[model samples]
Target: MSSPVNIPFLSFISLDREAKTPIYLQLAQQLINAIQRGYLVPGAKMPGSRKLSELLSLHRKTVIAAYEDLHHQGWIAIEPNKGAFVMDNKTKMVERPYDALVSLGNYPTQTGYSFKQSNLLDNPFEESNCTYQWNDGLPDVRLTQFNQLSGLYSASLKRKGTAKKMSNNQASIYFKEQLSNYLNSSRGLHISKDNLLITRSTEMSLYIISQLIISAGDVVIVGELGLFTANMIFQSAKANLQTIPVDGQGIDVDALELKLTSTKIKAVYITPHHHYPTTVTLSAKRRVKLLQLAQEYGFVIIEDDYDYDFQYEKSTIMPLASADLNGMVIYTGTFGKSLAPSFSTGFVVAPKNLISEMQKYLGLLDRHGDVIMQQVLGEMIAEGDIHRHLKKSLKVYMERRDNCCELIAKHLGERVKFNKPSGGLGLWLNWQAPISLLQMAKFCTQKGLFIPKNILYQNRNFTAIRLGFGHLTMEEMEKSLEIMGEYLSSLP
Candidate 1:
């Protein structure tokens, strides 16, 4: 038999009596580690239980238990008198240094293999620790009625029928039916549960749709100033993106019509209810013209009415999908936009055939959907909690919108120009002064405000900003805008 290898076992085999793990199991694991690392070679004689116990200052019975565990696990063998021996692993040991062997247990910082990367799909959102922040039109989560939602969710959990159905991995059929009815009543979307596919977010809906429609090098059109994340998705799918002009009345239908005469366009993406970054609603005439053009040109229209629920002006305009008789439109929006951050709950409204196909792709992407969250939201709709919540929240948001517009007009004076958007949570500010937006963002950051770069649109022709006021209180909005005004005043 080979002699026991001279390894400093104390260097690596550490024990903590305070830890929840029992001492015997920890010792057994550490011994296995030593054997695998070649510090204890095959056929080597291990120190006797009593001898090792004295060397390590542990009870003999603890060492004996560890040895018995190793023996049962096949890592070692024990004889009546010879004691424990390391078992042969059938492979030659490399016998690396102690420090090198310890380092090898750590995870690699980067991949060892090469792969493709797409700069087009890089994340544009940034994280910061600043005192204040801005986003591109998101609802204020603080205003959400979370207590009511939590009660609803708790009730759902206690229901035996829901628990049994969920255990079998069934989709939330009730939520789909309730959501479909809500959309039909609110958005004028003529659809049933079969025409809907619930998604984690509108971004996920856009991605799944892009994959099904856009082939490599296919022509996809958008406004010259479009939603940045949506553009990234289309480009990542290898679509040849083309941009038409957007003005005060939304996307220039004439420019789009002119482009259609020459190119075989695959689809056109729009935030028609309130154009992203600009907040201009597509005019009634343009809506009719655009629908006519879609039929004539045979292209898909992706309408993202993200903030349709928060309109403060005269009754909100119905989405284009409401009047989509020929089924040329695919409408997407969030169902829980007014609720707390727990649910992102986005739904896509399309023809039943297309929805059936999208469901397959959705299954591949999000195999296990959030059934519990859906159940809670469905309950909210059924009990009219959603309608009540929106009605109560709308008044508060309207006040904030009015206060934000007044502050901008009063403090900034002639330095900035904007329209009080009729519906969405944000206002589009067109900077009139000659100031670099990047430099202004840096200046704001210095004064404890974090203006995300994605919200700032700057190029040679124009400098614009989409300042979201919905997420901030009146006091916060005042402070943020004051800092912004101070920076603009100091600029030449």
Candidate 2:
């Protein structure tokens, strides 16, 4: 019979009683360190838990837990009747002292590995040191019912079965159905869930649509003065973007028609409902003409109805997609402007086949959206909470818009020319003076007001500003406009 092996307990194997780390983990880690440092040889037998506990003045269970942890981590192994033994070392090689002295700049740049950045990356907006900011347009988040939304989110979280079902695109079904119903009733569009693809934002929807339809060197039409972000997206897609003049009645379809007669246009992007920067709704005659032209030329109409729910003057016009019969119109909209911008929810309404294709691209871009948020928003829509909220917000915003327009007239007067926008959140003001918009923006900044470069629209023939009123309170609007008025008065 073999004699019983005697295992030595090293003096360094002491535990710190005051340390926050538990005894078992400390012991396990220390043993691992010992093996890595070559102090404990491979396949060396360890003291039995009973003997170790006696030697270390610990409970037998504590020592057993330490050994079990080591065994689980593959640092050591235990035999049936025998004690624990150290396994072979798997630690990484130690770094040399000289390696730490090497500078990051010592490595040479790889040859023939150049990065070509896109021109679209030159962002026009600059961060300013101003207290009051004039945005393009955004919703006031203070009006949102956070308590109710939070409750709904919590309730959805508790429903584990429902959440499990939603893991594989099932969660968006109910929300999409509710959204479809709402859009059909409100926007006069006849669409089902199959025609919709919910996205993270309107930007994402635009990106997906651009990817699907606009190929390299394809001729796409946009308003001469249009949404800059959307134009950037089309440009990034390598499309040859042709610009059509925008007048008081939105994009000039006559110019579009002339272009069509000469060129093979693939798509025409427009903001029909309260156009961007200008806020001019395309006239009814122009709408019909544009739709007919789309049929005649076989070009797709991409209509972005960003702030359709905030109309205060006449009844809102139905989207171009509502009147599209030839399947040439693709309508995209967002709830961000209607609700809080942070609660982003945008959707695209198109032919079923196009929607199916958009979903494939959407999957590649984003595998899933916020399921709980969608579920909560769907409930709000079904219960009419969203409609009620919109109604309340419309009343408040109408008052704000009126106040802002009146203030603009009182302060800036005839120096700035503007038409009171009937439906949108901004008033498109054209600078009648020969002052440079870049200089005016700088003057405003000096007076503690920030007007982003992107919001200050300027081309060779036009100079304008889209002063948004939705997000500002009456007091803020008054203060900001007063500063702007002072700057304009001081300008030569």
Candidate 3:
């Protein structure tokens, strides 16, 4: 037999025995790299597996396995008796130079072309590694009945006609019907399936609503301190947002009246259940006036009752959609915070005309939501599992809220001032001390606690923090508060 072709390039191939990657895979990858870099020219006859294995001090089977892999990937061709040869077209290999083929020991900084990011996504924060994290009004997912939910999901997947039924959108109809009944009974909403549109989450619902009503330069009113995410959605839609001051009684309706008189307002978004970031419930009188203004000025009222089921002190207030006589209210809510944010489901209740339009937009954004999940959640709602879960979660969360409040009082003392929110899962602690919120957050993080950048609110007129207590255990809450208190006390 003719002497096998001696490949000088084999001298450069090396393998790390301790590496978690298998030796065969390492050999295969190096050979593939050599082919891509043009070091092994196409049609070049390769050394016999036995000879190559002896030269590299590797088992013959290892070399054979690598060769088989390359052949499978079309990088090389195996002859009946001769041996292996490189394929003529190296296009199968990813483009890279021989020198660049060397491992860089870490992720590459840049690939061929780079593009600039939009200014809208500026000032992104890095992910935190702190052991203790304080979320923003999220539920304790640990308490969720996952076993039951899994059973429901499994049962749904096994249904004989599930695939065919979902294709026709029949699954969503059941969800809508169940959701309609639940809302009517729980939130005093008077609505049927025709007026309801289910969405993936509350954010999706807001985006759809913005698309339906907001146009370029259309005046949309929001509170001075509002949901930042929702504001981003409206701004993305090119709506001219007008911010009215929010006080102890929610958005200043009188100021809203002045804006309405001058400009043709398209929509006003309000979280009446518990104003985001502040946790102040909209007063009854303001709710009445706001509805009246919507009727008089011909603007749609986008009422977001995000956490209506978590009221601890008194009876929950009914949504504005319940008493909306002029059909001017577009109500949006989410079951995310009810059990766990991961299990989030959003729905909108509005006039039939608007609901139909919103569904058209929804179809474009998402043809249909999780059909199996929808069916599972529908069954949960119909069987009172959701209600019972809420009731049990409400009790647990209330205790946690109180525990958090006591810890803040004990640790922060006179340095922090906050009112016990009647409902909701967060506390808006107005810092009475002369310390920068950014500084305080950094100090807490150094001590193994994570406070997100968005929670640290500091502008010319506002200086406070919204601490969420729902997701944390009592022990974690206490430790986090102690760290926070120590930092504040150390401040001048």
Candidate 4:
């Protein structure tokens, strides 16, 4: 056998005593790296542990443990009288030349192969470490009843028969049954477990629906000012998107009707409870007209009632899905906006046949459904915890909405035009003053408040923003609004 390469172990193999990794493990990993990188070739003898430890200023036992580890992992071999030797790993590759600048552990920056890219699916979520931030109508996660939820989750884990249920890949049937009853009582949705497909988010539900129903070049329709994320999902699925006008009431059914006469549409995605960004409730007349058109034209209506629970008014309209008689509507929405985001559940209420098809796609995406969370949610719905939570949260959110509107009106004044929406976490402010929305966002960020670009809608026709106040406290809201007010007033 050839002697060990005269390569200096100290030159390439480094040890950081202060690192969290154990010294022995770190030494072993570095030795493995040296072997894989051809600094130490196969069948080369290793120096005795005592000599190596003395050279590296480590205890001899530490060096012995590292060698033992390498031997256990089959990277090296040891015999009674003989020392360790590098084993042939059998991975064929050209020996890489040593470079001082090269790092053995650095991950590759790009893929070796080409991939299809869709600009439409570009990330709308921005990363920010700022203390103050705005979002597109999200719940205040701090208000979640985590103690009760965690207790329920913990109890479920210790239950007698939970292991049997978790061993299988099937979704939580008991939870679905409970959720089905909850929807019937709350949303007027006459759905059963067979008609429901649980998902992590409304976006995931929409993606599954798009994959199952939409083909390349299929026509999908939305309002002129629609949900940006939903439009991204449709366009990414290769749908030919057609937009109709949205007025104070909602999407123009008359325009939709005219378009239906000339072209065939596969689906119409609408947030009718309170139209996204603009926050306008669909008129009852238009809702009926839209449903009638769906039945007449054989098109699907994807009704997203994202914030149905927080409506402050005495009178509220049931979702378009409630009145859907011919199976023309595919209703999807979140169940627990009052709870923390991790506890929120998304459900789709459609005909049983359609739901069955969606299940196959869901299985492919999420093989292991979160059964514990489902159990907790199911118990919450059945035990009236969800109802009480929603009732309590609605009062708080209503007050926030009122306070937010008052601030906007007092601070923004005549510079902006807006209507206090009946229900929703956000206020849509149309900036009448001549100022760039992008510039306002940048200025706000400089002042330690981050405003995401997705919430800023600017064009030649109108400049507006969807300001979310649900996550902020009364004090935070006041301070944030004051900052925004100052920025607008200071601008020419």
TM-score of each: 0.89, 0.79, 0.81, 0.91
Clash-forming residue pairs, model 2: none
TM-score rank order? 4, 1, 3, 2
- Least accurate stretch of 10 residues (summed lDDT) in model 1? 98-107
Flag regions of model 2 displaced more than 4 Å.
1-100, 103-113
Model 2 Cα lDDT, one tens digit per residue, 116-182 = 7887958866786688989887778887777877787789778866757476766699889999999
Give the alpha carbon lDDT tens digit for every residue of 1-492 in model 1: 344445556666777788898888888988887776676777677889987888778999999999999999999989887778788666553433554344222345989899998888888999899998988888888988777778877887788787665866454678889999999898887788899999998989999999899999999999999999899999999999999999999999999999988999999999998898799999999999999999998999999986888888876789999999999999998888987766758889999999999999999999668888888888888889889999888888999999999999877888789988898899999888557888888999999999999998888888888999988998999888888888977866
Q: Residues 158-203, candidate 4: write the lDDT tens digits.
A: 9887888787633388889999998888788788889999999999
Which predicted model would earn the best lDDT? 4
- Error at 1, model 2, angstroms: 48
Itemize residue pairs with steric clashes in candidate 4: none
**Residue 70 in model 1: lDDT:** 94
RMSD to the true structure for each prediction, in A, is 3.1, 8.0, 4.5, 2.8
TM-score of 1: 0.89
The residue ranges of model 4 lying beyond 4 angstroms of the native Cα positions read: 1-5, 8-11, 54-56, 79-83, 88-101, 116-118, 127-131, 168-171
lDDT to native, each model: 0.86, 0.83, 0.84, 0.86
- How many clashes does each candidate structure show, in the order listed? 0, 0, 0, 0
